[model samples]
Target: MPVIGVLPYFKDIHIEEEDSVALAQRVVFPRPGAFNIAVLALPHLSNFTDFSWIERMGSLHVYYTDDPAQLAGAQLIILPGSKNTIDDLLYIRGRSLDRVVVDAARAGIPVVGICGGYQMMGLTVADPYGVEGAVRTVDGLGILPVHTVLEKEKTTVVRRFRFGATDGPACAGYEIHMGRTEAVGGERPLNYVGEGFDGYRAGAGCWGTYMHGILDNRAVVEELLAAAGAPGLEIKWFDYKKFREEQYDRLADHIRSHVNMEGIYRNLRLQKR
Candidate 1:
């Protein structure tokens, strides 16, 4: 079993100032965890909210870390979406996490990547059209037998897909990426989207998918956590839309019953005194 430790929420690193103004804010940590997951917070990470719901789950402790050493205790490692695949792949190599992630997967720790992270898990990524940066080919993590060729036209769509070769439920997610991945060495796919395959699963603990909200489905998440050795953790079947709707209704009721618009107006009038 991997060593699970409760660490600080996020590192206190200096974020460069942009035209947008900001101030220091509190970073909320997850509850007491049964499973520890480390997410690679790349420089241009996007669509990170895909994991926000899972972070709120009681059974899992998800933290974003850039240090390769932090991969030691993580039972599952997630390579999150990035705006720039080539640059982020280089960043992972620079941090020496490429080998670390590969070794972790080989050791039976489940590894998952979303979007650009999926691109990095392939055998090779060729950006011939310079969709991201320079027109170059970079070696991927090689966990999966797929190769990606970035195209000028981006694919953005929302669809429901059945899990490929697994007993998992049908998952619905959106795809927003600029590359098309093709399996070259007959690797099993992760899911089937429309008439085509969408992802690849390598070995017992490696998975790469273009789907963004793959983990949002209850059945999929449960199966993954169980494979990562965090079985029997309570699966809180949450309806996120219903939760938001109830919150909105509760806020409206509170305002209609307890808020004092007249008293506020009178108070504002008397504030001159």
Candidate 2:
């Protein structure tokens, strides 16, 4: 309890930067949406920000919930990345959201999963090495024909990949997970990382992948929207990578604006004299 008193500031403050063209994150927003997306709120959800880019694209409303009734009207249902796959999987089952996901898949609703969520889209996930806390296996949602095994060494790397063919325009993403998922059969790969596969697609609107940030690419987002049967909804394109870099530049500018570097240097020089 004493540690809290000794630590740094833990409250709200303004964050600004260069010329203010770079926007600050505001808690309140005027949400005018046309698409309803339900992201499963797993107990240990890690990369929920993976879908933040979509919120920038106008007309999409993404919210997280665990209730089955709340998922009923969603055009797209996403299972975001989790830190503890086994624990979160058990959490999903305990809430009976597993049945909801399975039923949604059968009903042909667009269902997507990333990283730990991707592993849960398969038939089985075995933690033989106890990398996920227990040396056991659990049944998955059965949406895709894949099997996952959690090994000791975790996979953490950035990847450039393309959907369908190797010659397509490459999109950027990063993988950070302990499981290695393999195709059991029937499911077509969603993308190619180098000459190898990275994700699986069983049918229309059903796919799973270990890659994060894949949605940042306009082409990939378009395909995903189309798969979700939103062809009428047109996507406004922007380079998310470029946008991210601008954010960093603005952050630097913000720091410079607040800190008097020249004054500090003069004070240090006088002290030495």
- The lDDT values for all models are 0.76, 0.76
Q: Write one digit per residue (lDDT tens) for candidate 2, span 37-128.
A: 77887767776457657866767777677777777668788888887888888889888889988898898888989998999998899998
- Poorly placed runs, candidate 1 (over 4 Å): 1-33, 166-168, 244-273
- Residues 1-273, candidate 1, lDDT per residue (tens digit)? 432332333333222233112212212232244477888868787786677567667667777766787766688888888888999999999999888999988888999899899999989999998778864899999888889999999899997888755444688898999998999857588887666777887744578899988878776777677788777677666875565466667655555455565666677899978
TM-score, prediction 2: 0.82
Query: TM-score of every model?
Result: 0.77, 0.82
Per-candidate RMSD, Å: 10.7, 6.8
RMSD (Cα, Å) of candidate 2? 6.8
Give one clash count per candidate, in the order shown. Answer: 0, 0
* lDDT (Cα, 0-100) at 122 in candidate 2: 88
